[model samples]
Target: MYVSLVCRQWYAVTRAVLVLTRPVVWLETTPSSQLLPQLENTRTLIIKRPQSMKHTTYVTWRDGEIQCWTETLNRLRELSIERKIKINKIEIKRHIRVDTWLIPLLTYTSLSLTNLELKDMVHREIPFGQMMKLCPHLVVVHLHYRDTGYIDSICRHANKPEYEPAELPDRLRLQSLKLDNVAIGRTILMRILRLSPDMEELHLKRVAKPRSFANEWLNTDDRAEFSQHILEQISSICPNLKSAHFSYYICDLRSLASEFHLAIDRNLFPEVSYWSFKWCDLSADTFQALKTTPNILTTLEIIDDASAEDHCQQHLHEFLCGAPNLLHLKVPKTLFSITWFDLEGIVSTVGHRHGSTDSTTTVSHRKIWACRNLQTLHIGFGCEGEIQESAENTRLIFGYLSKVCPRLQDLTIRYSLLSLELNRGFCLLTRLHELRRLVILTQCNNDKAWNVDWISKLITPSLGARMKHWAAEYSTMNLGIARARHPFTSTVKNPLLHHLLEPSIQSTVNGGDRRGDEYGHAANAERRKEGQLSQLVPDYFINGVDMRNLGQLEDIVELLQDRISKDWQCWPSMGFFELICLESDPNGIEPFKDTIRICRPDVEVK
Candidate 1:
């Protein structure tokens, strides 16, 4: 029965080898009795080797192999002796905590192995240097976890030499090396630098956690010595290194302070520029740290969580003070009010969490007068100021901006009361030679009042007037037709004549009041009460013709176009009227673009 089971296992092993072509394909092994037929039937089990196949090998735990007949095993060993078949790659997995099974394949054959990965194999009391001596052409090596076991094995093999033994790979010319969770003290870092001289990529993850001695060394001198060790590695070993990443503050910040200075001393970092970090604390001293660093740092994003506001502000102030080649600057919202000393090389300034100032009563209006090359400014006004205070402040702030940042193109003032009148402080905005687009926004539900007529008159008069005229003409015609049964009533006043004649709407529209007769319905009165300005015309005009019903938007457009064509010299900028019906609230503007488009096709809704 045991013999039959061994035969079945050997057959399974032979079938597996026949299907798998690669020699080093990792697999779980079965019993030893299945070994003979598996090796003999290798030709039948394996596929025809690819013509381009340079090398192929197999690797698996000894236990994963099937049991073979004793007669087959003896025959295979004799065949190897007779035919000299060299194994290219071999891996003996130590599943049952066994030492590496050293085969005679490396000693007898001239075939050299390039890729070697010894995974859970017991490193029998042998130095790592000795293992490399067996395989000279090794390129990639991975030593992950179980470091203590391997270290114990290496110390056992430490030979008594005239000089101290090297702990790292010196003979092997490696390209990639990965050490994960491996306990490496300060000695290991310096050793790696000397050994893998041609190494390009290095990942020391969680390796710094327990091994970094700088954390435990309480004496400043001990910490300084530890820091010096790292600095020497960077200068001697990683001189040509293009990329580097290290964390957990393993080195003393005070000892290597000069290294930070030397980085920008020469024009060294031309190709190396991008820097990103978290929880970086730079006191007022940060300016001295990065002042002469050249224009290599073009884009920088810093997320600082400093307890002191001045510390954060001081760092940014210094960085911007010197970085003349910096094109874009993105800072936190808290620093906007911090009065920038030198904002050179910076064309754009983005302030996060800076739009509103509602709770604070007295906001000292700060102006950015230094940025001469500054073009775009986005100010987010907080919900602090009441309508009048907000409007007055807006005028003052925009006036300052126009004078200081003359080359401004696009300006967006968000969440504040918008004033069109160039009140004392606002007149300076007109001096901005390059100002083209200006946007003012307020909350969706806030009662933020803005005189649309005033803004349209100032920004785009031709389009503005056309919209005003259309509304006025429509209202007049509608009022004329919808007069009351008693046409001369005081309540139903003449809405149109009140505005054109100018003095007062009550005096102008109350013409029929003396006769004690009402003219218009309750709906018209409701609209008139909402600050509806009036206009005057002669009494002989169309009686009850209802011009509002007849005057469609298209008709107004055609009328304006005709007038402009006939009198182009008189009305140069005035042509077809373009109406942009903004959401009475700021939040509604974008969503209500369709509404404005449907009403006036030529109008720019957004």
Candidate 2:
């Protein structure tokens, strides 16, 4: 408005540029008719209003707002109408009906629209076939219905005899489709897939079982059969599909087995390189079939299924042997207890070498090789036992990985117990010079041996010097103790660690309100009290330097006093030193505090 107001000449030039660029236009309230002309060239449009205004009365207002912008949507390439309210206390009712608001928008942008995202839509009978027909040029479509019940209702409506099917275009331009909590029938889902024959990625989450089956057994059987059929059809129909994800409440193991079998038999999914199955069970036969399949998967994630661990472990080698190019592997803890012998076998197989049965070879001469291309490894142990029993095994795994997987950059381990021995095992990871990010989730025992000092020990000079990011979470249920801490030492040459540790002034003032109050008092009196307190506190220095500076001296004194008052009599650990340094700043301490809070909310940074 200011530029246009400069002069008539300026107005004409600026308007023309605005028309050509057509930047994103965000509307929070009802768009007026006058504003429609200005948005004629807009490429992206977003309509998001506050929850307070998403009431029944505002439905008409939003409907008119969308209708007013219909004509201008002809040139629109992307549109997102996210009216879903995220407040936990408020129950969201239908704000805008899809048929009334969404269908018209689709019709208007039918010629040019490429991306469409409809989030938090109320459960209703959506003419999906007709909607796809309206947007023939759509390349990406994301729909998140409220729940599976709504999807069940839609499935029922679509299957009705009175429902008329729309004619789909000869070739769809769609490349990606994501549906959350959708429960359409097999036929309806197939119809939708048929419309996107060239899709490259498909993600279906929380998909409900069809309701047409009479009994639980029949429903499970039918679902499995349908799932297998869909995979086969997708392989044939969408040969370009490269990635797929599926998640559900009850997994059909038989269906998964059949799907893998069909993929092997028909040599399907040649182009697919990524697959994720959440809360799904896999049997030994499925793994056998997977091994037979020729697909060179780059990433495979199978999580949240404890019952399938034994089967996965028994056949994982076979399956992985087939996928020599696998780069990312995520498996349950139960399936990840790989022995030294198993490690050697995998190395030999991946490197295409045959090793001797004799065990006389030295560790160095025994060929450090396996999954050379693997870059990311995530293992979840599911909180079954203490880490003490498996400490040596876990350590050996790390030692092996450091030598074999030279390209490994990211590693994540969850739900394990940690002690001094385990920390030492982690230190062995220094051999992985390429490693950039490391995350460990463990329950720390209350014993003095497991203090925060162990964290510094894990970051050996070699690892600490190269590691870009490292995070750890520790808790003591026996003592009702929890603490989250991160290392932020600037003296270290590691720029990543320095950036992570850099203090924020605002967090310091906020986290140190009590100390800030004391500092606000008369300087002489505060110094006298600090001198007295310093005598009672132990002599401590950070990074081998005595704290003579005012900021460092004040922070340490306050921290000791707080610990003593709380009756936490344990000696100050490295965590205390880091906290004191983080709280030394009055303006820049939030990022450090937030890293600990978000990673381990139970641990008190104070």
Candidate 3:
């Protein structure tokens, strides 16, 4: 607005640029008709409940407050219906029930809305029939967190809620519906599904009590019967659904109803190429069943709540052997291919723990991974055995992966656990020409082990290879920001630096063997002559970054007590540090990205 004031040319350009961005309109602030030019694009609107009503419960909301919002919405109606500012999307993110404002909202706004999202509802009842009829162009809908039982418990003497017409008037152009954590009735669920017969995606994270959707009185048989009906008809109903994600919740109900996700029911997902499962309690039977089927999955993710590989019936082996079309597979757990060994002393009663093995199992059946075309792999790698044997096994694993999944671009693993030795383990990954991102999650003291030279070696300039992103996050977090005293001399420019970081008084930034490793002989010579960080290093990194190596147990920082170059600062809690440089490009988020690109597009900086 300030820049546009210079001339009409700037205003015109500003308006044109503003038109590209989806502008937000606050429903409470009704502007005068003179400001009509401001709201030329009425695509998305945000309405908030009156601030005065924040402390009050929904049940006790005065009619005055309700009228305030309704009147404000009427102003928006005048703009849309009369002024012809066509509405494209309306998302009600308010925490109150949908029924309170939705009916009047529909009456007062244009019915041509293409997208609608009402996810944060406190009550279950919503007029689905009315909403679809009002907005026929609605393509995507996200309905969630509607728990009427919660309302009854919170508010005393609450009247029994009436669920108005749950059926749809007609099939709209709805293509996607994400229903999660909702306690909706069966009629409502079926109605919503049938409303979008040609739906493309269904993300049912957790739809509790499908039986409660119909039955006023619920039982075990109600759940079992509902689950059976869902498993049989879900596929036939949404015949055009290309992607679907189904997961379990509320143990008792899940055991009875959500059996569609239990591995054996391949018919439930006829042609779903992209599948994901979170805390689905998947076991060896899940992958074993995939082997018997005609595998068409391109992406598969199964995450456990415990993350303890308890079910070991060919769990890792099954996926590697089966899914030939697998491109992206992420099961965040440490998996070992070799069998007959207790890992981490986790003795589980679920699967058979082999106490003995034949001599023919010298290789332990650790073969090449079957997912040869895998591009994105995020899983824990572990080798359980003798030291030399473990190193050999790791070598085989990486060597095989390098050959098999040459197209692999994204890889995430633990730092110390991977044991990525430059020669034995890490060197095997040199053949992976397409690898772009290597994210290693480190525990406490592993950050200083890898330096710029190691990174350069990993990038392998000989092959014209370059890493797009290299991130290593320290997992150990500090609860309190304890400002400890510096172990080194406090006279190092600032006392706060010494106190906060606790660096050794005997050493400076480039003192002792530090100079030899950081930049090799070049930095070592410079530091030897200067013998001070003022000339060799800057004050920004004195106590500004992860100062554990400078001598501290954990990463420490004092944000308010700041003094240094303004370009950089560190907050250990947020996983921000000065080390571990990121490779920059034209598409990078830095302010000078565009200028740097124009100046030197070919030059890469980290």
Best by TM-score: 3
Better of 2 and 3 by lDDT: 2
How does candidate 1 score on lDDT?
A: 0.36
lDDT of 3 by residue, 1-606 (tens): 334348887777666444424546443344444334544555665555456544333444456545656665566667656655555677765565455567666665546577777745665455556667776778887766543433111111111234324335556677887765543444445656776777888776555444434333333232212355575566777877766666543534444323543534565666677665654335555555555555477877654332334354256555675566789877655444323222111222123223222223322232335676798887654433322223333443455455556677776654233434332344445445566665544221222233223222212333222111111111122212123332222223354464454322222332212322232335446666786543333221221122221111121112111112131211111211111212222122332223323333332422
Candidate 1 vs. true structure, TM-score: 0.30
Q: Model-by-model lDDT, in order? A: 0.36, 0.47, 0.46
lDDT tens per residue, model 2, 1-606:
334447888766666445423334435454555445544445565555455654323434445445554543442323223221111111123334666666766665566667777656664545666766787667887666664343433344444435525434555677888776665555555666776767898877656655433223223333412356667776777788888766653454233554555665566778777776653445566556545556767877775555334445545544653454779987644334333233222222222112231224422222222366788887654322332434434444555565456577777665343322323344445445455556554443312332233233223444333232121111122112101212112122345554554431111111111221222235434555777432111111111112211111122223323333343322222122122221223233344344444434334443
Where model 2 places Cα greater than 4 Å from the true spot, the runs are 1-112, 117-127, 144-156, 161-164, 167-171, 203-233, 244-249, 252-255, 278-281, 330-369, 386-401, 409-412, 416-606
Cα lDDT tens digits for candidate 1, 1-606? 122325866857655334223342222232334543344323211111222221222223233232222333355456466653334444433221223223232332213444444443233333345455556665554443333322222222122232124544464465445443333444434544566666544434223333344233222222212233454454566444433323223322332334434443443333334432222423334335445555455444343333334445445544553454443333322223212311111111133222222222111221123344455555443332232433334433454455345566555554434443322223234444455555545443322232222222132456446545654564565454445221211223457653433221121232211211133334345644774634322221111111111112222333334333443221122213222223543453433334434433433445
For model 1, where is the 10-residue window of minimal lDDT? 540-549
- Least accurate 10 contiguous residues by lDDT in model 3: 466-475
TM-score of model 3 (CA atoms): 0.51
RMSD of each: 24.2, 19.3, 17.6
Q: Which stretches of candidate 3 lie over 4 Å from their true place?
A: 1-112, 116-127, 146-167, 210-226, 252-268, 278-285, 303-306, 312-317, 330-361, 376-606
Q: Where is the poorest 10-residue window by lDDT in model 2?
A: 504-513
**What's the best-to-worst order under TM-score?**
3, 2, 1
Backbone clash count for every predicted candidate, in the order shown: 37, 11, 6
